[model samples]
Target: MSTKTPTEDDILRPIKNTTSKWFVLFGIAGLAFGLFLIGWAYQLMYGLEVTGLSDWGSGGGVTWGLYIGAFIWWVGIAHGGIILSAAVRLLGMERYMPVARMAELLTIGGLSAAGFYIIVHMGRPDRMVTSVLGHYHITVHNSPLVWDVTVITAYFVLTATYLGLTLRYDISRMREDLPSHFSPVYSALTYGYTEEEDEVIERMVWWVAAAIIIMAPLLLHGGVIPWLFALLPTYPAWFGGIQGPVFLSIALTSAISGVIIISAAFTRAYNWDHIITEDVFRGLLLWLGFFCLMFVWFQLQRIITGSFFAGISGTYATQAMLSSVIYVGALAAVMAVLIFIFAQALRPSLFTKTRALVAAVFVLGATLFEKTFFVVEGFQTVEFSIYEGVPGPYFPSLIEMSSVLGTIGMVTIIFLLVSKVVPVVELHAVEHLQEGHEPEQEAPQEVEA
Candidate 1:
C-alpha cells in the first residue's frame, strides 16, 4: 500500500472534478431512461395488455410478470444494502466504514426503482394516491402489497434520518471545502449543527441500526416484500417459511455484489486505491462467498420442499424450474461463482480484482433471473392446462424488457447526480485512514474470515 496521507482533497475530487467520462455516462443513462419513459407512456396510453400479462383462470397465463418480479428484486437489493450498512454500525465493522455511504445511497436508489415499478405495473400513476394511499386504511388490514408499501416507506424515512444525521457532522467540518453552489442544501442539512449533538447523533444512529436489525427479518417491513408472495397459499411455489431466508440471502448477495462493483468503479475512476484497498476487496469477496453459499443452500431447501414433499402444484413448479434452460443457467452461473470464490479463498494467489468483479456480475445477473423466474413460475399451473395450449408461455413483452433497462439507467443517474452533490465517502472514513492512525482490529474476526 502507498504511504500517502489522506486529505480533504482526496475525498473532494469527485465534487471538484467533472470529467468527460462523467458526461458520457450521464448521457447514456439519460438516453436509456428517456426510452423507458417513452415506452412507459405508450404502455399508459394503450393499457396493461400491451405488456402481454393475462388473467390466471380461463383467460390463461399469470398476471404478475417482469414488472412484479423486478419490483421484488429491486426491493430486496435496497433492503439488503441498508441491512449491510446497519450491520457495519451495530457490529462496529469499521473496515467497511468507507462503504457505508455508498450502501445508504444504494438503498435510496434501489427503493426509488422498486417504488417506480409499482407505478409502471399499475399503468396509472394516480392510482397510487387514489387506490393505495387513499384507501390504505381498508387495505392495510389484509393486503400484503399495502404492507410492503407502508414498511418500505418507513424504511426510506429511517434511512434518510440515518444518513442525514451522519452527514451533519461531515458537512459542518468540511463546509469550506464543499462546493459553494450547494450551500443552501448544506445549510438546511446542518441548520442546527453543534458539536455537542455529535454524541447524541451517534446514539440515535446506533438505535436505528438496532431497530433495522430487528425488523428486517420479520414477516413485516423489509421481509414483507417476500411475504407478499409467501403468504399466498394458492401458490405452492411462493408459499413457505424458507422464502424469508432465501430472499434475504439473495438480497445480501446482490447488495454486497453491487457494493463490490461500485467500490471498484469509484476506486479506479478516482484513483483511490489506497483508501479502498485490496484488504477491503478481499474481505468483501469472502463475505460474498459466505452469503452466496447461503443463497444456494436456501435455494436447495426450497427445491427439496417443493419437489418431493409437496402437492401436485408444488411439484409442477419445481419441474418447470428444473426444466427451464434460463432457470438452470442462472443456478449454474451462481454455482460457478461460488466455486471460484471458495477456490480463491483457499488459494489466495488466484484472487484478482477482475475475477472478483466477474463473480459479482455473475451473481447479480443470476439473482435477477432467478427472482423473475420465481415470480413467473409460481403462477404456472400444476393440475391441468385450462387453456389447452390456447395461451402461450408467459414472456416479457418488449416494453417490459425496456422497463428493466430503463430502471437500471434510472438508478445509475441517481448515483451519478448524487455524487456531484454529497461527498460519497464520509469525512469520518478519511480520518480513519489518515496516516499514523491504525484502526483497531478485532482478532476474533480474523480467524473467522
Candidate 2:
C-alpha cells in the first residue's frame, strides 16, 4: 500500500488563515517597531547623552548598560535556537523534527534583534561602520568586538543558507499546490532542483549543522562572548575562566525558554496542539531543567570563588551576587519544581502543559533579570583607584527601555512575516507522521487452481 503524503494545503494553512487575532498581533508589533524607529531617530538627533551610558572617568557611569545586556541575551537566544535545531538533526531525535523549523526561524529572528542592538549601542553607527571598513586590519586581530562581529555575521549567513537550501525540497514537492502569490518565491527556492539534488542538499545541511554545533558552544558563546567580560581584569565579577561555561548554560536555558514560549503561542493561536504534541513540550522542559541546574552550579562556583578572597574586587563581586539573591532563588526554585514535574510527567496522570509553560516563562524572566543584574552590578561597584569616590548611577534611560521593547517587537514581526512565506512546521516531519499512520497491506494468498 502507498503511504499518504501531507498536502500543501495542510502546510499552508497558517498563511491562508487570516484571523482577526493575527491582525491584532501584527498591528501591535508594527506599532512597537515604529516606536523603536522613533526612539533611534531621537537618539540620532540628541546624541548619546540621552542614554545612561557614559565614560567612567569623565561621567562616572557604565559605558555598557541595557543595550549590551540585551545584546548578550539576544545572541544567546540565537545561538541556543540553532543549537537546538542542530541537536535534533544530528542526534536523530525525530520526535523534535516538528519543531526544528521553528527553532531555526527563532535563530534568524534572534540574530536580527541582536544585530539591531549593536547598531543602537554605537552612538554613531555610520562612523563606526566607516572606520571598520576603512581600517579593517587595525582592529580585526586585537579587538574582541571585531571578533564578535565576524562570528555573528558568519553564523547568520550559514544559518540562512541552511534554511534556504532545505526549503528547496519542500517548495519543489509542493509546487503545484502552493498559492499564486508564493509562486515567485517558490520558483526562486526550487530553481534547478532535481530528485538527485535532495541527497546532496541533505548532506550539505548535515555538515552545516555540524559546524554550528561545534562553533556555537566553543567559539561564539563559550569563547568570544565570555572573553569580552572575562578578559577585562578591571571587572572582578567578570574576570574568570568559568565565565564561558556559565554563559553557555545561560544561553541554553534562555533559548529553551524562548522555544517553549513560541511553541505555546503557536499552539494556542493556531490550535496546533495535534502537531506540536505534549511530548515535545516535556522533552524541551526536561532539557530546560538540565540547563537551569547547570546555571545554578556555575553561580555557586562564582559565589564561592569570589567570597573566598578578602580583596575589594572580590568582596564587591560577592556583594553583587548576594544582592541579586531573589532572582537566583526564584530560578533555583523553578528548576527544582520543573525537575519534579518532569519526573512526574514520565509516569502518568500529572502532566499538564500549562505547568511546564508557566515554569518556562518564569525561567525566562529570571534568567533575563539575572543577566541584566550581572552586567549593571559589575559596573556599579568600581574597584579602580582613580574612580574611588565617584558615584556610579547607571539606570536604563527611557530611550534604552524603548529600544528594548522595539527589538522584541521586531522579533515578533519577523516571525509573523516569515511564517507567511514558509511552513513553520517541517513538511518532511508531517509526511513522516502520515507514513507512520498508514495502514499496512498484507500479502495476497495463493490462488487455488
Candidate 3:
C-alpha cells in the first residue's frame, strides 16, 4: 500500500502550475466550442428549420428533439452532481470528499450547458426576454416551462452560494499560496472573512446542504422537471404520475456516471491515484450500479404502464419503443453495464479502476441515448390512430448533433478555467486527510519490576 501523506501542495498544484499540455487541451476544447457556436450561428441566421425540427406530429418531424433531450440530460447531470456533493457533506461521506468539489463544479458546468440548449432550442434569443421574462407573472402559476425556469434560477443561486461559502474557507487560508493575478476574484469571494466565522460557516453550509436535499425531490429534479412532461394530458406518451421518481432515478444515474468520469479524469491528470484511489472508484461504481438499477426499475414501471394500462396512445408509444432497435439496444447497454458493476461489487477481485471508468463512460452515453429516445418517441407515437405514421426515422440534424459536442467542450472549458483560479479539491478535504494520516502516539510501556 502507498504511504504518501496528503498536503496543501497536492491540492494547490493546479493553481500554481503551468504546462503546455494544459494549454493544448484548452485550445482543443475552445475549437470544439467555437465550432458549435458557428453551427448555432447558422441556426440563428436561417432558422431552427435547419435543425430538421418542425411542428408536433406533422411532416414526420418533432417539435422537441435532440435539443430538448440534451437539455434534460444536462439538467439531470447537473442536479445529480449537487445532490452527490450535498450527500458527502450532510451524510459525512468523507471518502467522497476528495471529489465533492469536482462534482459541484460539474453541476455549474452542466447547468450552463443545459441553459445553453434552452437558448439554442428557442431559435430567437429575444423570446427569453419577451416570452418568458416578460410574461413571468402571468405564467408562473400555470406554465410548466415557467416552473422549470424558476427552479433552475433558484438552483443556480443555491449552487453558487454553496460553492462560494466553501471557497471562502479555502481561499482565505491559501491567499499567499494562490496566484496574485486572481486576488480581486478571491477577495470578493472571501470578503468579510474572519477566523472565528469558520464555525458559523460550517453551520450555515450544513443548512444549505439540507435545503438542497429538500429541493432535490420537492422542487427541482423530482418536482417541476417531471411536471414539465407529466402535466401535459394531451401528450399521453409524456403524462404519468411516476415521472417524478423516474426522473429522480435518471438524475442520480446520470449524475453518478458524470462524477465518475470527472473524478477519473482529474485523478489521472494530477497523479491522484493515492488520493482518489482504487477504493474510491469501487465505492463510486457501487453507487452508480444502485442508481442504474433504480433507473431500470423506474423505466420498467413506466414501460409496463404504457404498454398495458395507459390507453391507446400510450400503449402505441410503448409498443413503438419496444419495437425500435435503437431504443432496445440502449436499454440493453445500460443493463449490461449495470450487471458488470454489480458483479464487480460482489466479486472484489474482478474490480479494476480502469473497468470502473469504462463502465462510467458507457453508462453516461447509454443514459443520454435513452433520454434522447424517450424525448423523440414521445412525439413519434403521440397519436395512436390518425398520426400513426407521422413521425418516422427521426434523427438529429448535424447542427443538432453538434450541440452535444459544444456543451461538452463548454463544460471542459469551465473545469479548465476554474482549476486555474481555485483549488478544484476543497482545502478542508486535504486538511481532513492530513489529520487522518497523523501518526498515533503510542502508550508508554511500564517497566518490568
**Which candidate gets the maximum TM-score versus the true structure?**
3
Candidate 3 per-residue lDDT, tens place, 309-373, comes to 67777887888888888778878878999999878778889888788888888888887888788
Model 1 spans > 4 angstroms off: 55-59, 219-222, 382-391, 435-449
Expressed as tens digits, the lDDT of each residue in 1-449 for candidate 1 is 66666677888889889999999999999998999899999988989888878465566667889898888778878888888899999998888888888989899988899889988887788988887888988989987667767877898898899899999998999899989999999999999899999999999999998887787777433367777777778777788788889888888899999899888988888988877878888888999999899988988887788788688778878887889998889899989999999999999999998999999999999989999899888777434454555334788888888888898899999989888888888888788888345656767645554
Cand. 1 TM to true fold:
0.94
lDDT of 3 at 289: 90
Q: Which clashing pairs does model 3 show? A: none
Query: Total clashes, candidate 2?
Result: 0
Over 4 Å off, model 3:
56-58, 383-389
Listed in order, each prediction's TM-score against the native is 0.94, 0.92, 0.96
Give the range of the ten consecutive residues with the poorest summed lDDT in model 3.
381-390
Candidates 2 and 3 compared: the better one by lDDT is: 3
Please give, for residues 297-322, the per-residue lDDT of candidate 2 as tens digits: 88888888888764887787787678
